[model samples]
Target: MKNKEFIFLMILAAFLSATESYALDIEFSGSRHTVIKDKPEASTGLNDVFTIYDIKEVSFISIGNIIAPSDFRVLIYSNLGGGYAIEQPVSITGTTAFIHNPKGDMGYIVEDGDNRYCFWVVDYAGKHFDISSIEAYPEQDCDMTKITVIGSGDQIRYYSVSGRQCTLSRNIELSYNTLEWDNENNSYSLVEKTAGFEYLQTPLTLRPPFYCNTTVTVSGDRFLKTWGLGKTLESSIIEANGIDVNTEAVQTNLAPDDASNMIKSDGTMLGGSAPADFTFYAYVTDAVLHNEWQIADDPEFEYVRYRFNERDLTYTFDQEGKFYVRFIGSNADGSCEATGETYEIGIGASDLRIPNVFSPDGDGVNDTWKVGYRSLVEFKCWIFDRNGHQLFYFDRPELGWDGKHHGKTVSPGVYYYVIEAKGADGKKYKKGGDINILRYRKIGNSSGASGE
Candidate 1:
């Protein structure tokens, strides 16, 4: 029983393999222009059709390896009037049939048993189209432009700058083999191809309703070789210049010992000690005839403090208050004006305080000795041991010193700190205090001495 089942399975496998291997080999003969074997775009509904470019008025097609020679029939159809089949004579020799003098842009169907093979023949001997020039015409309306393509072709395709297809109009349609007849089902069905792959008639001219930065491409049948050269036209509509105001608050004057004051603020809103110097810069997309920088006390600019007509400005904020700054740019006619981003500048009064106690344990609570500061522009801090040996030093008020020297934790005892600073409000700071580091010693652990 097992041997018989195995034998039956082998026979079935052979039958299936033989069925899958059966294919009709179709060949074209005679002097032809060219043959484009590349598969058509899936949207063309001609996935199974092979394009044949013929220069001569006539061409021959040979269909060989027919499963049944008597059952093979070669049928030709026109692309017009819903595709009507033309009566063409076929000469048969052995298992092959010869099709004589097929027409251009016509569909050919070869029927053998329940299988049907289809293809398209494009005549390339007489088709002629070329792109002369492309021009752009601006309209009276803003951002409205008319683009004209001076060329001729059977169809035209539009593309973007990045080579993406753009839809022109959906109502336009070109005739091609979009449907195939099913012999076994005895009915006509739509071809298994993606939709919206149709091309438009050439000599195209259209004005886009809106304005954008894009690239336009015009081409005929992309799959054909004899089709004329494709031309790309770039159209850019110029508009008013865009303006942006970039600001930076920099401290130019530094104390002789405060060399680490390298932090600069470059944002719309900034808060620091008074007497800050800020440089304003204007970035414009196009040329501007007039550029002005304005500083006001209120956001609405009800009372303007200062106004400067320049491309860039360096202003000093000596008073303690919130100020609003903006930049304006305009064209020669002044009809087109653009305002840049508004900057909010805040100047605070200066004050500084130092902490007396801090725990440097791993609990993350006050792990470092840091000073309580408000707008101290120029600062210098030093941490020293009882032996007068400096352990850490910093020139910025925001920086702190952990209770470690040379990568080792110092002894939990009172340390000393000295600070010399100057505020933006012209105040001076000269202070010194003791910093105590309190740590709980673990069992059987000895307190390590301070590192040098």
Candidate 2:
């Protein structure tokens, strides 16, 4: 009744006509005893009351843009157990005011106090049903957009952050379907409405660096210039605008004087050991960007990352191998790259010891004539007789001679041996000396024969 019009659908009208005998109606109230007649019912306060004047049951209630069953959930509550208790669920027809209640039907007084009952409208499915007035359900939270309207007519406008214009009159119930423009505030606002949550706008494109101008300077400040049309001194001045500068990555170049050394686990330089750490030194140069140095284990540069100190241009290698490293740098403006040449480092070459003697009588004690070297790059060993005839030859250090040539055990003698080995430092080492092969243990000796 509150100066608002109620537009009922055709189905609602027909249904109301059939149930006119019940005189079903909703009532509203104010603090000063002012009653609104036939208005869309809204709860004014905790004490506000609503009544289903003379209805036996309710199927649903229509409020704002929601038509019940199709858009929201409705529940009826009875004042019981010192508080309001939910009584039953109500189904709705998208077009009617109230239909037949399938659950426990109640033909009783509905109010806001102990003597009456109450109802709830729920947006259980996230349909974003906008309840126009807080007075409709003062105790329940309802979806609504709060807005302030100012000005009149062409000067009126709706105001909100990034708002739009308003078009509706003052003090009217608003819904998601309503769009009003306000001219005075120069912004748009939803009087008491909601359209769910808004999504973020698309991002703007990023612009690349641009070169404003490029001036080529000459050695002399004032250059002597000759012109046909006009005589003038040409200065080093080239002016332009909107010229994009393409950035490139710096090239990696390593110095030839770079050094690498193997160290023991105790941090001492490696002399003769297997598990030794290695350190690589990158000579500081203009083209080298210490912070951008990247070291890899394999030739393909797909190796494990090692800890490096850019201030010293050094990296420690815990494993043994040839590692590849390079320097890559880029300007802050992203307009140029400086890459250094790739440098290879060899490590784990401190231990290359060849035994001076071995008793190869197969007693498992110095049974094989071999060299002990960690990460040996390449190796070849040869044993010769007094006349320089090659008695035994071996290529792999792991596969050494057993003091035998073609299954024939050689007699115990002082044999001359030559070893050619490639160290992890990429350097070839040749060692020739006399190896005394003493037959300390015979094949079946009861007491192992001992000899010098």
Candidate 3:
């Protein structure tokens, strides 16, 4: 299979350089002209060469300094032994002439058979005239179903005749065939034919090229069905004159800087519950024409939790750390992703410590033991008594307990407390410790005795 493909490519290259065997001549009445050299005026000017692959809808020719109907009459010669003049109307802008097939005609397709035809622009009165460049465009109803490339490689993708990426699918019967060559007999024979593959029953409009060792398959259907119906598919081999596919437009190239530190509100290393804000920065190159930007933390990008403008290129990290950001930029062809640098946030316990002891004797000194929190984005504390009773609960570290239970003072005892907090780096922390309640003894003396 590989050898055959190599041979096919070589043949294609040779054919591309081969000159057309047929030619069209324009005769003059007074001053006869034999051959029209490729001069800028007569033979040189057309934006592109006329071919069925590049031209789907209509063909436009720009001939400079063309004299109205009286100067030249256009004719086409077909090896079918027939010569005919084009009756189509020619529109002109300045000195450039525009030619089109007559109304209700399917434009023009250069015949591929031995009886091929050549187009000629000549002076109607046998006067000399110059021909410039010619260009072709897809007509409203051009047929391309007869040509196709069957492969399963990445290069196989759907594109409009105008060279824009497209999506389309059509029901097509695919068949695989191979040729067998006999060494002694020096003859070639068909070896096998398999057309029952369900995967090939319906060929996707966007088919990739097949790798080596893959079977050669052909589409049974003539044309591909596009957005609606009757849309045609063109071959992609450059030498074959297919639309010029722009590969870079579908490429993905984007990156985000690595190794970001989780910081406190003061831009210092986040410790405990500091409420700091940090930004993640990424960039998409100007050369990449991507239509979608994807940002996620999961390696597979299961979901995207945040988004930032392409120009801004920033993602604010509010409280979570050890983030694995993935940035993907893509178009219709495929997608590429960049795994950004990981950021780890460590909030030191010293910044958010809880006092082990406090007294609430109503004397205004050490009335409550509040959980110490520095730069905390979120804080929660739960206090439980020795018997497993939840004595107090608060989300703010500043909102501490007053040593009261059900509106009554509880007996002095040791209590257990749990603390949970989120720092500015977007990290969660949990710690628990024991707390002691101390009360001064009240001296009961009837005789004006002051309590010590």
Against the true structure, what is every candidate's RMSD? 17.3, 24.9, 22.2
Off by over 4 Å in 3: 1-317, 320-350, 441-452
C-alpha lDDT of all candidate models, in order = 0.55, 0.36, 0.37
lDDT of 3: 0.37
* Per-residue lDDT of candidate 1, residues 1-452 (tens digit): 25564344323322221244556666667744445544434333232344444535346777788877777776554443112344468988998888876666565655577555554555544444444554443332222223454544443222221123333222221111123335465433443222122333332323222222234443444534243333333323323222222333333532333322332244446545544667877654343578888999999988989999988888877666788888887666675556777788887777787788887775656776777665566888889999899998888676687777876777899999999988766788999989988874423323432333
Error of 1 at 181 (Å): 55
**Superior by lDDT: candidate 2 or candidate 3:** 3
* Model 2 TM-score, 2 decimals: 0.31
| Number of colliding residue pairs in model 3 | 32
Predicted structure 1: lDDT: 0.55
In candidate 1, stretches whose alpha carbon ends up further than 4 angstroms from where it belongs are 1-32, 41-45, 48-56, 76-88, 124-127, 140-147, 154-271, 280-452
Provide the TM-score for each candidate, comma-separated.
0.45, 0.31, 0.24
Sort by TM-score, top down from the best: 1, 2, 3
Backbone clashes in model 2 = 45
Ranking by lDDT: 1, 3, 2
Comparing candidate 1 with candidate 3, which one achieves the higher TM-score?
1
